[model samples]
Target chain A: MVKATPLAIDIHNLSLWYGDFQALFEVDLQVKQGLITALIGPSGCGKSTLLRAVNRINERLGDYVRTTGEIHVLDQDILRNDIELAQLRRHVGMVFQRPNPLPLSVRDNVLFAHRIHRADEKFNRRKEDEIVEHALRRVLLWDEVKDHLGREATGLSLEEQQKLCIARLLPIKPTVILMDEPTSALDPKGTAALEELIWELHGDYTILIVTHNMAQAKRASEETAFMLLGRMVEHGLTEQVFLAPREKETADYIEGRYG
Target chain B: MLTERVQLSTSIDLDHRGRDWYTDKAVTFLVFVGGISAIVLIIGIFVFITKEGLGFIAGSLDVREFFGSLAWRPTSPTKPTYGILGLIAGTASVTGLAMVVSVPFSLGAAIFIGEFATGRLRETLKVLVELLAAIPSVVWGFIGLSLLNPLIIDIFDVPVGLGVLNSGIILGLMAAPIMTTIAEDALKAVPDTYREAAEAMGATKWQVIFRVVLPAGRNGLVAAVLLGVGRGFGETMAVLMATGNSIKIPTSPFDSVTALTATIAAELGDAPVGSDHYRALFTLGILLFVVTFIINLTADLVVRRAGRK
Candidate 1:
């Protein structure tokens, strides 16, 4: 077996606690550059928490949280107190499970991210429109939303809202993208569309996804990590893990004996 | 045996009827009393103010002078006069000053408590604000009179602390609790999704508060401000104690003035019935009614619009 080289994000012995409730326990994982890694688990298994930890967004929970060990992103220690969470977040953008576009116009939602992440860039209305249009086009949403660019983003359909959210994140040009059950709230058609977009996005950005759907894990990622009760059950190439999981727990979970 | 059974059946039937019927009647009576009392009181007050003030408003009372005049004196036996311009000006000045003083601080505290403050600190700060709100208005008035009033007088001058400025400062102290609490509620009412969305785009905390949270809470904050303005405008004892209660237009924060509520409280006593002086006090009541009604109505409109979004 040939392992990948130069991990984009390296997590070492990471443990997390929300007050007395431990969420992640001594979990170690590596995500390679320009590839998708899926963290799959049953509900309450801390897949989302582990994904949030990679970008240090878990710190937003405040003092109730206690995290130990290190998270390295591009050879930099992301867990260090000195790390700028906002800047790190800009580099590692997130897309939530629900479609959460701003209250502003669709055009403004896309421009807002660009304005925040790239403040030094000159404020040109036309240039902003171009950037927004390009992002919308990248998500295959431009044809649907182009005429209604000035409409409130909340007015969009659920699928369009999710696509708009994706467009909003793209303008920042983040190197890594974290998604927490991105299509869990969508219908079959919307979910299929989002899956295709995720596949396309894999070549340009390192993606870390947390999902409860086993089929989605098989379809969307190259590597898979299975977790159970705050512990890593198995982690390996997607096909190998699904076909011949090394651990008994992994085998049981894959075979639908228990989660 | 038949007679005994019939007597027993009649007695049981009477007992059941009496108890159940009486209970239902008592409940209905109580609810009716409470509901009717509230509606009657509200309508009664409105009718009384409008009826008493209408005659004076219709006869010889110049609306322009009443609103725009610089002097307000409705207490002269020989040459009686009545004009609300000074009181109106005073109300505007005090409320404006209070809003200016309270708005920024209240918004900052709201954002801090709602967005930035974490865990125990957030809880502590919230408790402190609630305690501040719990303090009685008269107690606040007394504190302002004894402590804040004198402190300002000594620091700035007697005139500066005993006028519109003093009234405004006292009202600001009173308004701060309402502003912070309501603003905090408004900020919290903004969905977590908005914050998450903003953060995901790498927006700073300040940027998120200003651009997203504040705008989203615009209507609620406006309602908060209107409520605060109503409280400031209608406050009697605090303004009466802090303001020197002079019936003159104030030039600056450093001059004494009388608000409509203060004027009515001070002069309603000893004004003979059916006199212009008496009627004018009722007219001041009318003015107060109009001001508060307008403010509350505007607040309702804003809140409705917010709900639509």
Candidate 2:
């Protein structure tokens, strides 16, 4: 038997509806292991919705929602009813558009994931310090926040807060991280910094990011998927997708003709 | 050309004189009236309370005996004791008890209504809580007398239904709705971003409520507690009916007691004119006024701090 490299996420023939309105139609894609893939689209193109569907976070929105499809994460069907949301979410962490740190000390925000998900009380002061230090260091936020770990997280700058959120996600050791327009609210310098961090993190984790900036998609991703009107118009290597798009719509969007 | 320019300038001046001047004056006058009315009302009420309370503070009347003595029997001629210590202690005990009973249940209900329930269920629970607030205190008192008092007495094997326990329970029910409603509003005012952040970190629903939502709305929660305390302190009919109108300090939940508002309401109609008893009732009124003032001031400070944040 010929063996195939297993994909991290596989979505096959997925359709989603919010009551009478259909949002996505027969979307198919694959996320490769340990690489950064960017989903680029205009506003209202269902990019964020599709990202939310991978972790089943959309199911918590309301009862009127209906989804017909199969989504697989780590070779396990995640759309099944028996799939535990908490466990799935623990493995698939997310960062939102705006930086939303808890109204707590910086240290607590970093350790929140472990405290909530891990039931072990035996991790004393030394282990806790190690975990906090490692998580913050991974996101390059340890030195800036080390002295004021006891200070409130809300008092940080927007860039620092977003990085703190990333640090928070790291403590859970998620297999994949989903970012929805992570730098849309940031300044140019902040955006460049976060882009660098995303590239650095691509070595160890699968990253699926939704961004409207074509340059950012081109810069940070190994693979890029272009979506328009809730449909995936093109999916290929980042270089090929930008230079030689298969569809005219993808080329036009990348060329800034029409969203 | 010069004549044309002068004519155009004159028309512009006429337009401004016709509409702008009158509208601006009317708006300014209306604002002045509204602002002055509010200030006057506040100052007037303060003046009234202070005028009545000054006699008790002045040395012309004995302050030590009035505040320190135990007995509150005003009609006894031989050794009439008009101490406010017992009444003040009684009021504090009842108010404290009412808060203890109401705070937890009201907060739980608020969290459930605001964060946990589905759309229709949340609407239904909210309607019920609003109805609870709308029910008159006198009606609550009647319910306590006819229904709750008997039940409590039977369950606890007490001699009478009217006691500290009965008043506290009734006041708790009366205050719970306000606490729940205010707290729900506070919880709802917390931005969804905070909740989403917590949930994204794989936090359980309960943990999100306790860790993220509650802390984000701490100032509002404190305001709600203060509002509930005010409601419990000023509650008159229910406390009067269920407390057995006792003047002694309450030693336990089963003992009969009286609160400041209850004392004023129960004795004001029969208090003799220009007598020490009348002055003492005014004094009770002063105490109630001070309590409400302090609670509202604290609430204002908390709200301001939250706004600054």
lDDT of 1 by residue, A1-259 (tens): 4655667888999999999999999999888988899998888888999988877777677778899988899989988988877899888888888989999899989888888877677788888889988999999999998998999999998888888888888877888899999998899999999999989888789999998788999998999999999888889999999999999888888788865
lDDT for B259 in candidate 1 is: 82
Query: DockQ for the candidate 2 complex?
Result: 0.70
CAPRI tier for the interface of model 2: medium
Worst 10-residue lDDT window, candidate 1 chain B? B6-15
Candidate 2 lDDT for residue B298: 99
Candidate that scores best on TM-score: 2
Per-residue lDDT for B1-309 in model 2, tens only?
355543344433434477778999999999999999999998898787667666655623567877887778877878666787877777778788888889998999999999999888999999999999999999988987889788988999888888778888888889999999988988998888888777777777898899889988899899989998899888899888888777787777888877778888888889886566777677777778888989989987987787677
Model 2 CA deviation exceeding 4 Å by range: A1-4, B1-35
* Model 1 misplacement above 4 A: A1-5, B1-25, B71-79, B134-150, B157-160
Reproduced native contacts, each prediction: 0.77, 0.70
Please give, for residues B1-309, the per-residue lDDT of candidate 1 as tens digits: 365553345434444567779899999999999999999999999998878888788885877777777656566656655667778877788889988888877888888999888778999999999898778878867876788777887998564567777778888878888889988888888898898788767788888988898988999899888888888888888888888787777777878887889888887887777677778888889878888999989988987888788
DockQ of each: 0.64, 0.70
RMSD of each: 5.0, 3.3
